[model samples]
Target: MTYALHQGDALRVLASLPDASVDAVITDPPYNSGGRTAKERTSKTARAKYTSADAQHELADFPGENKDQHAYGYWLSLLLSEAYRVTREGGALLVFTDWRQSATTGDALQAGGWLWRGILPWHKPQARPQKGRFTQNCEFIYWGSKGAIDGDRNPVYLPGLYSASQPSGKSRVHITQKPVGVMRELTKICIPGGTILDFCAGSGSTGVAALLEGRNFVGIEATAHYAAIAEQRLRETQDGLAREAETRTT
Candidate 1:
């Protein structure tokens, strides 16, 4: 498998790509949850209920520009437009978003010409708790197709509810990083041996998962720091895979 990591803005990098260049898009973009309510809650809390870490340190400290709901929707629409342009017909896009923005995300994808498929819930068993409310234990993956989705012949036959914990141990690179197990399962639903594009590459979890599943990858990250981390992680994953292959042959 081959992969390229671009250290630049996701929109600009995606715009430069050729049409129909990727078979799938699996990305975990920023949730834009840095509003006043969220900020107050985080400030009042000391540690996250799920883990012992400080609440502020649970996720990445990157800048999220979409503090306003309207701005967030507009930004998402622009990004999805590029994703739709680069993705091949029948290709799938599985994007992760928080509950607050899930509806807007779905609307944006529809406006961008993607056929709205359905939502896949990622159940976090170790989710942080809210005392007066339900545990914020689930995130939503908005699934859409470039064109039509044939139910009977879908490549990925997995259930809508995916129960997986966050990345741990050696897999934990980025604060908002997803587990490779979850990514690998999602990657299998893509066109076999086709290219996968992740605009918000973060720590390159998607790229690593794509390559390990025998698919090519193109990942674009805005931050140089995260991009460097992503590159290192991808290199490590590649090396490990190569060693495993050699061992099998020997």
Candidate 2:
């Protein structure tokens, strides 16, 4: 299976794909800051149009006493709704987010008619414990299916938590980048040989994981720089796979 990366807005790119085409979706989208990630780390390598400053300023200027960034709910509503339309009858949507937006996302999904399955806690092993509060090393991933029930479909149990490590080595990747191991685990639970879509795309971890597991992937990134990096990464994976296949044959 081929993994291709596209440089464009995720919401727009996703809309162009055929309906009910993808079997699964694994993504880490913007908390809507468009600039820095949740940790306020600069996505210096990302090619997105919006920046953390833009999102923050927009929220700050929002006409209300409440300065809450319900941005994901508003943006994801359109994306998730489209995701529902593009997913197969029993396909899945795996959405990643920090604690700040988990409940809001849950409510949005429910209101959008998505059948909530379970939540996965992504535990970052290398994360430093927070002071004055419990260690904030975990992120929430909501797994939902197109159907109301998975009675007849294959049973894919969602784990309460998944342990992974943060990126420590040198890499021209975005901040808050997902780990390959985490993506692999998520992919294994989805239908095999299925087409997967990742809107946030990041450094192409989801695509790499999908390719390594013999699945097809299509990733969309808002920034051209990151998209180019992802495309190159996919090509490298393909070449590596080809070499491995040839070695086995020889």
Candidate 3:
């Protein structure tokens, strides 16, 4: 189990990697909500109702969040293209996006030469309800393969919808950090013992899951602060796994 975390722009870092270097790409990039829309959606009242005071201020401030639709689409396409280049043939790419950008993300995935598989819905059972509106309780995971996928035929198959509660405030290192269980589930579907790449690693939840599952991980975070946090979290994850193995051996 190996892991490396780099502090740099995801696009630049991804471009530097060699072709077919990674076995899988699993990441949660910015939703590119144009800042204003995201701010409007998170009204003060809603924040107070949903998150604690400390958690409210810790919301992520990452690059590309304020991009207009056109720019966001272009940026997403470029990133996906790099992902496709680095991923081994038949490797999978799983990216998380919100409803507003799901269509664009899917289109970008196809544009990047990835074989469009399908959307995986992540159901957050504890999602907050809005008055006079349907609850926004799910996020979409865009799954695609770099080329033809080769895998064993499973008599029983997993469903497209994955039900898991969102990460609690206490466990969140990044504002949009995905639940560890969600990352683990996605990782399990990839080739065993293969390397996982996350260019927009945020707080490194994906790396933690990969290491815990005995897979190699390469993560790139744009901000030094978040990169440091991710490194610490990954170190802790490795330590925990080592302890578990030692205990089991004894």
- Top candidate on lDDT is 3
**Predictions in order: lDDT:** 0.81, 0.72, 0.82
lDDT of predicted model 1: 0.81
Which candidate should be chosen as best, given TM-score against the real structure?
3
Tens-digit lDDT track of model 2 for 72-155:
577677788887778788788888877767787787666655789888999887666767878867888988888854545546
Whose TM-score is higher: candidate 2's or candidate 3's?
A: 3
Give model 3's TM-score versus the native structure.
0.89
In the range 120-238, model 1's lDDT, one tens digit per residue, is 89998987688899897888899889888665554466777888899765656676788888898889877768899999998898999999999899999988878999999889888
Q: Positional deviation of 168 in candidate 3, in angstroms? A: 1.8
Residue 144, candidate 1: Cα error in Å is: 0.5
Q: What does the lDDT read for residue 108 in candidate 2?
A: 66
TM-score rank, highest first? 3, 1, 2
Model 2 ranges with Cα > 4 A deviation: 32-68, 148-158
lDDT of 3: 0.82
In model 3, which residue pairs have backbone atoms overlapping below 3 Å?
Answer: none
